[model samples]
Target: MNTDFLVIGASITGINVARELKQRFPDTTVVVIDKESGCARHSSGRNSGLLDAGFSWSPDTLKARFCKQGNQQLSDYCERNGIPLNRCGELVIARDGDELSDLDEIQRRAEGNGVKLEPVTARQAREIEPRARVHEQALFFPSSASVDPAAVMRQMEQDARDAGVRFYYETSFLRKAGDEFVTTLGTVQAGYVVNCAGLYADQIAQQFGFAGNYRLLPLKHNYLESSEVPGAFRTHVTAAADLSGSYPGTQIFLGVDGKARLGPAVKPALWREQYHGAEGFHPFEMSSVVTTGIGQMFQGGGEICRACLQRFTGSTHSRLITAGSRLVEGIRASDYRDWARPEIQPQLVNTETHRMVSDFIVEGDGKSMHLLNTVSPVFTCGLPLASHICDQVAAATGR
Candidate 1:
């Protein structure tokens, strides 16, 4: 196969890159390949589907740069495509006075990132979500929304196909063969390559001499579906912050259908694709992940270990209920019996620093570009991130 631009991994990022490239360079051929039978079978399809309003990171980070815009663009995309969207918004509440400052920090980030965040009194918060609890004040993200991820992805794939972006499903990238790539399907000769392979992106990029110091640290994210009627909660609700200062703690995410979900226990996984018991098991990857995790636990003054213990060593449902109960009333273990589809977060780690990377990493030269650490909120940031990546591709290929 020969194409002007070849995109590996047909998830949100890869699909958007192909579509954007085709849009920008109409004369050039753009193609996307994925090992799955269809697009977004992995992380993209299994996400929480919460369109973030971009207050998580500082303004200096790339995540901040893309998230707010990505949220708006994606919200617009859903509306234009007639996809269902619940504009339920999100509430960041404080469990107590100790965590109140974190809300302030998040509000500061919201302002810095040029996103609107409303400071609501506890009464106002309850007015928004009757079950919501707050110590004094809570931050409301009006732009925050949710959709059926699978629905959005199907629409996006269709959009890409309609735009003349060719997709080769069940096609795997094998190796680089001298200015071209050897894939399971056939030899692919492309002018430029973009890697968005998720779990295996770092491994693929290593072949192209990028992502040398970065490696995939897969975190298994699982959510609990609430049995209560839809609209059990009027909006997504969560506490201020957790140990890592990110919002990975117990919280409830409302789907586009208004169903409440609690979870996303971000625990370290044994392998890259270790979604369930022994599924997608890779002995080599497991060994590497265990060793790396052990090393990180020792180096971070046991911070990683403490975080792991707090998150991983428990009945996941009970932990979620406990944490989520603090944010809103009426959370019980029985109501959250069903576990949603679990996903592996292909998080990137700086091997040398023994730290998890919180921002997106893009590395490229002339031949190829690699996107690493495109983790949570990436689905929300897909459009803008795709645009940024295309800019990198243009610069690298002189397009």
Candidate 2:
């Protein structure tokens, strides 16, 4: 198949790119390729689904811009397409009495990003959430909301097909065969190629002399839900904790069917695509073995959940030793249950700096662009990010 625009990876970014590309060049042929059977089967499918308020990233970066705009665009898309969305705002609590300054910093960053935020007293925070414990103050992001990430992508695939865009599923990109790409299915030529394959994007772009010193530092997170906290969180609530200590800051969301979900114990991962005991799965293998740190083991999914629980903050790390029965005043230890499925987030580690890349990185000219980092809140910012990429492509292709 010969296509004018070839998009690699059917994650939200690639799907949106295909949609925008087709919209820009109605007469041109656009082809989107993915190795999976359908879209959002990987990172897009396995995520917390919490819409970002753009208060985390620096205001002077692409993340702040796209995330802020994408929040609204995606919400509108969901509303128009009949997809589910929860506009229940967010409450950013302090990790401790000392973390109020961090909340203040986030508020300042939100202001710089043009995101609306207001500080609420602890009394008000309790009024908003009767069960959750909070500090003396919390930042309220009115724009923060939640959406069904997988559902959004499913609708996108259908809409893209209806828009005359070609989709090649169950087809994997192998290598560049002269003017075409050699895939598991067959060889195909494209005028321009875009790499948005979240996990393996580095390998793909490196073949084209892109992604200089970037490597994926896959971070794994497990969802721990309270067995009986249903309808507890009226609005999504998170902590204004520092980035250190592998702090998987807690978040209480009014989840599907009115159940309350919590905790995403974030930890660096050894495997990018496979989780221990996750249905006896492995992406590609040569029977290699690697050991975890002291007092750590990954036998399977259940073991992974157990290991993550060790680092998980559960309900109250801030008040673990500081508070008493109030931490579990209405919540019980047995109420803490983890979801069977876990999510893996893509984090690009800059080998040059030995630090994680905080902002989104795009490489290559408009003709061939690669989305280097598609992490948290990306689904929330998909629409604006796609438009930005489309603009770059238009200028590069002189379309």
Candidate 3:
């Protein structure tokens, strides 16, 4: 097979990249290949579906640069395409006086990022959501929303197809030879390649001589579905314990159908696709992850160690219920016994510096471009990020 542009993954990033390339160079042929049978067979379909308001990142990061714009663009797309969307809003609450500073910092970031966040008192927060438990004050973002990820994924796939993009499913890229790529189906030649593989991005990039000092540190995010009625909680309520957006401290998110779900107890995984027990297990990948985690624990001033401890302590059913109880006026542990579909975040860590890469990363040359670290908020930042990447492609190839 031959094409002008080839995209490695068919998820949101890869599909949008192919669409953007076709839009930029209308006469050129664009193709997308994925190991899965269809789009969103992985993380893109199994996420929490929260459209983040772009307040958790510093203004200097790429996440901050694209998130606000992406959120707006996605919301608009949903409205125009008849996709189900819930304008549920978000509440960032402080447990006590010590954490009030975190709310202020988030507000500062919101201001710098051109996002709207309002400060509300305890009484005012109750008016917004009767179940909320606030310390003294909280920040309310009316622009935060939710959508059905699977629905959005289906729509995006159709849109890409409508735009003259070809998709090759169940075809995995095996290796590269000279100027052609060896795939499970066969070899192919391309003018340019874009790597947006979620879990195995680093491994694929290494074949092209990129992502040398980075490796994916997969984290399992688990959620619990509340058995109560749909409108149990009016909006999303999250604890302000961590502001790095690395650990989504105890949160209750309302789905597009108005059902409330609590969770995302973040814990490190032993392997890349270790979503459940003994499922998708790879021994070699487990060994590599363990070795890298041990190195990070010792060299990064025990930051990873502390994070692991927190997650381990809070992941249990009883412990998770306790944490959730503090965020809302919840009553029983029996209401949240059912666990939702688990998702994994393929976060990147700097192997040399032994620190987590907090921002988005892109490493490429004239022949190919690799999107290495697209962690949380990438779903919300997908549209704008794709346009930005296509801009780089234009500059590199003079298209």
lDDT of 3 by residue, 164-198 (tens): 99999999988889899999989999999999898
Q: Is candidate 2 or candidate 3 better by lDDT?
A: 3
Query: Which model scores highest in TM-score?
Result: 3
lDDT of each residue in 1-399, candidate 2, tens digit only: 788999998988898889889988999999999998988888787676767877777767787888888887877888999988787787777756788887787787778888988888988877766654677888778777777788888998888888888888999999986677899988888899988898778778888789877666566666666676446567776666642123335556655345666565566556677555554344442121132221223322334335345554342433232222232136554556455366777776565554556677788785488888777767777788878888878887888
Best candidate, lDDT: 3
Per-model TM-score versus the true fold: 0.96, 0.86, 0.97
Clashes of each: 0, 3, 0
Error of 3 at 248 (Å): 2.5
Lowest lDDT 10-mer window, candidate 2?
A: 286-295
User: Which whole-number lDDT from 0 to 100 does residue 81 have in model 3?
Assistant: 100
Predicted candidate 1 versus true structure: per-residue lDDT over 1-399, tens digit per residue: 899999999898999999999999999999999998999998888788999988878788888999999999999999999999999999888878888888888888888999998899988988998998788899899999998889999999998999999999999999998898999899999999999999899999999999898766688888888899997899888777752274367778898889998876667789988888987789999998887787677664665566567668643666777877877889888898899888887877676776678788999999899999878888999999999999999998887
The TM-score that candidate 1 achieves is: 0.96
Which residue pairs in model 3 clash with each other? none
